[model samples]
Target chain A: MNLLLLEDADFVAADRAILRDRRLHHLQEVHRAQAGDTLRVGRLDGAMGQGELLRLDAGEAELRLTLDRPPPAKLPLTLLLALPRPKMLRRVLQTVAAMGVPRLVLLNSYRVEKSFWQTPFLEPAAIREQLVLGLEQARDTRLPEVLIEPRFKPFVEDRLPALAAGSLGLLGHPGEHPPCPRAVEGPVTLAIGPEGGWIPYEVEKLAAAGLAPVQLGERILRVETAVTALLARLF
Target chain B: MNLLLLEDADFVAADRAILRDRRLHHLQEVHRAQAGDTLRVGRLDGAMGQGELLRLDAGEAELRLTLDRPPPAKLPLTLLLALPRPKMLRRVLQTVAAMGVPRLVLLNSYRVEKSFWQTPFLEPAAIREQLVLGLEQARDTRLPEVLIEPRFKPFVEDRLPALAAGSLGLLGHPGEHPPCPRAVEGPVTLAIGPEGGWIPYEVEKLAAAGLAPVQLGERILRVETAVTALLARLF
Candidate 1:
């Protein structure tokens, strides 16, 4: 873990926090940390700063905190992604959070298998676990909000237009379309499709919702790679 | 598999091929392909074209190949990456190939675990397996050249200078360096460090070898994500 993330419940006092879970294990094993060692730390949805280890034990570790710095700024984008397979969903969650996406909408596409929705990985706590890992990887504090949309049509037709109204709505599909824009000026609403990509009718629906189609050349990247590539290219 | 990759051994006649392996199973299970189905196919390190399924059975499938189109062009870049942990190595190999990197050097770094060098994933056949999967995913027909450099100092000081002579040699390090350049013309030689990053002395050695250090903001990304992000931003 790059930063020792602290939840409110971990606090023993205003300035002292105890870690007794996996963080304690990481500190003992991965870090080989000792008392008096200073480590980077952040409060969940709060500030980031340093913590000086006051005590270290097999059971728990106590730290004196001085959280001051704000977390890194999130991307000015709302990502609308086709829910990937269960295996891919976990990695994508981590990737999305690591990349500093502020909000995510996991919407269904025709190609998304119905069975994917039943995966335990989609559970709120499970999703939060992956997001925490991403935050730990990136040393950030705030968690990105994730919204699930099982019905594509209602969400796209009734709500998407308003959500995309002030942003540059772009669809990441492989086709005869303009290349994805680079270093975009403002907020973007980007919709990426499933493995086989958005069907023609779905593409048309998205277009009507203001997400114009764009391509990233001929080579088809896996969903995780594509997410990273597109975010990197865009901002 | 997006493209049915055919090796020379699979070819029967000048314009025909047979599949009895995982490809046949994939055709039967994933694609649910039948005789008379026209599928995209590519020759290993050769042309991409359409294959007309002539026969399909549990044991084998036969196809009539009509090879024509050239594979997607590779990037004008050579990547020098510190060897990641074995699990990440497999995914990074696929990402490297899928993103069209022409060459990759999996070099050792100070922070790289000694056990990482002993992974069976580093074996030629194992490496080739991942690369082939990448090519299949991206629908490309060529494999990237992967070189292993177990000793860091000697490789950087003795050989990297000449290797990086004409290209825009850049190092992906996190520090007070310039932001990574975008949309550059011509060839590039990029060196990405390991998880904890390159030590100071190693960074200096790489600098002397003609690579200038560049940063990708404050957020630390995993090795695989960093690779995708840097490649996408650069080219």
Candidate 2:
């Protein structure tokens, strides 16, 4: 684990960071980390540092934090993603967080099932949990700010244009468009559709908001693969 | 299965291309497909088609291939992936195929364990099997081409530069750089690292070979998550 995250205020106040979380369990059970094992640590949405284990128990562990290193930078990109199935949502959140996209706009789409948005996994804590797992995997400390847009039209017509400024933007569509370019060295906002993809009207609306519709290939990728492929190519 | 894929010869004078090969087993055992059920079918390296019931035997089944439409386009992108563990290798191949990346080059890296090269999944038929699953998921027919390179330096220094031409070339690293752009358009040749990521010297080599060392964030993502994230940004 890169960042041994701590949430308990008591430990943070005592100049101590506790590994008494699910992560600690992971280290103990999966990694089998020993005391003085020097785990990489971070405070949520804060700085990154190291944690030297001092004590341990079945449920809790204590360590001292040493913030000497700066956290890695985040992507200057914001995601306008259609809410995905719960299981896929968990993976998407974790992957997005791990990749360090600073913001996410989980919007509604035509093909999206109404029930998908109601999934309990969409709750902030659950989202936070997935982000934590992603951050830990990437050895990062800062958490991306996630936003939800229950209404697609209002968000696209009213808010998206404003957010498009200084941002290289595009819409992921399996239609007529050149292939996606590599990192263009600036802020970017990308919008991806639900399972079947953005309806033509949705694509047109996003285009009006300065998001260009781009094709990945002839084959239709699953939402997850398309998301990953788009991010990787942009990188 | 959304598509039942077959070889060209498996067509012309062949049965329904019901994929009696292992796919039939997949249908019978995994999907529990019955005689009358219709399934998606495609000619390998060709367009998507459909199949219907005919006759069945202990080892084989015969049906009619009625091809009415062409498969979706193959992804113009190519993936230069560092071989992952076999367990991950299985799913990744399927996902990449589904993404419609027409070509893949799995190379060795410093972080790659020697044992991973010996995985049974490296067998040709085994790999093709995974690709088929990916095509079925996306309802596409084209099969992706996979290439394996055990040597890193020769492949990167000699073969990759020309291969990456006219393509957005990216090297995924965890360091300082501009954020990954969204909906990158154009031909793309993406390079990703092995489990522990490319060592500094290797990253430098890629940089020397015209790869732009890009960061997803401060966080280090798992290979699978990284792949997914990268694709999302690129598309």
Candidate 3:
């Protein structure tokens, strides 16, 4: 954990917090932290600063916080991803949050297996757990909002156009299309497909919704890699 | 498996190949491939083409190969990465290959755990297995050349200088450095540090070897994500 993230419940006072959970384990084992050691810390959705370890023990560790700095700015992005397989979803969530995506939409595609929607990983608390890990990895405090869309057509046709209206809507598909733009000027609404990619009809539907198709060469990257690649290339 | 990768041992004749291993199971289970099916296939380190499934049984599957197209071109880059923890090493190997990095150097770093170098994943066969999976994912036919450097100073000071001589040598570090360059022409030599980042002395040694330090903003990304992000941005 790069930053010691403190939730409101962990606070005993405005400046004092107690860590009794995995964070304590991390501090004890991974960090091998001791009393008087200063650690980088942040409040969930709040400011980041330093915390001086006041007390260290097996049960819990006490810290005095001075959260002052704001979290890093999130990407000007609303990512629309075709829900990956359950195993991949967890990693993608962590990747998205770590990369500073402000909003993510896990939408349905023809190629997405129906069983994927049943995965426990999509549960709010489970999703939050992965996002928190990402936050800890990146040393950020803010959490990205995640939205689920089980119906592809309704989401694309009814809600997507308005949501994508002001953004540079893009579809990350491998094809005979223009390369994905570099260092884009403003907000982007990018849709990435499932393993086999979006079907031709679905691609047309997305295109009608203002997400023009773009290519990232011939090599087909895994969804997680593709997400990082597209975001990196775009911004 | 996007492309059915065929090794030399799989060949029964000049044009016919039999699959009885994991590939056969993959064809039966994942692809649900049947007799008379035409699948995208690639010969290891050779060509890519269509394979007509002549026979399909529980024990074995037979294919008639018609190799034609050349594999996708590799990037004009050589990547140097501090060896990651074993679990991540497998995924990073796959990512490195999938992204078309023709050469990779797994180098030692101050922050790298001593146990990381002892992983069975570092074994030649184990490494090749991951690389093959990457090639299959990306539909590429060639495996990336992976070199291990257990001694950091000698590799960087004596050998890296010559290896990176004509290329644009860059280091992916997080600090008060210029942003990583985008869309550069010709070859590049990139060095990415380990989890806690390169120590000051190691950075200086690398600098003397021609790799100037560059940053990727404030957010700290995992090594795998950083690799993808850097490659995507640079290329």
Q: Considering every candidate listed, which one attains the maximal lDDT? A: 3
| lDDT digits (tens) for residues B1-235 of candidate 3 | 9999999999999899999999999999999999999999999999999999999999999999999999999999999999999999999999999999999999999999999999999999999999999999999999999999999999998899999989999999998999999999999999999999999999999999999999999999999999999999999
- In Å, residue A109's CA in model 2 sits off its true spot by 1.3
Give the number of the best model, judged by DockQ.
3
lDDT of candidate 1 over A1-235, digit per residue (tens): 9999999999999999999999999999999999999999999999999999999998999999999999999999999999999999999999999999999999999999999999999999999999999999999999999999999999999999999999999999998999999999999999999999999989999999999999889999999999999999999
lDDT of 3 by residue, A1-235 (tens): 8898999999999999999999999999999999999999999999999999999998999999999899999999999999999999999999999999999999999999999999999999999999999999998999999999999999999999999999999999998999999999999999999999999999999999999999999999999999999999999
Interface RMSD of 2: 3.2
Give the true-contact fraction for every prediction, in order.
Answer: 0.89, 0.88, 0.95
In model 3, which regions exceed 4 Å deviation? none
Which pairs, if any, clash in model 1?
A: none
Q: How does each model score on lDDT?
A: 0.96, 0.79, 0.97
Residue pairs in candidate 3 whose N, alpha carbon or C atoms collide under 3 angstroms: none
What class would a CAPRI assessor give candidate 1's docking? high
Docking class of 3: high
Clash count for each candidate, listed in order shown = 0, 37, 0
Winner on DockQ between 1 and 3 is 3
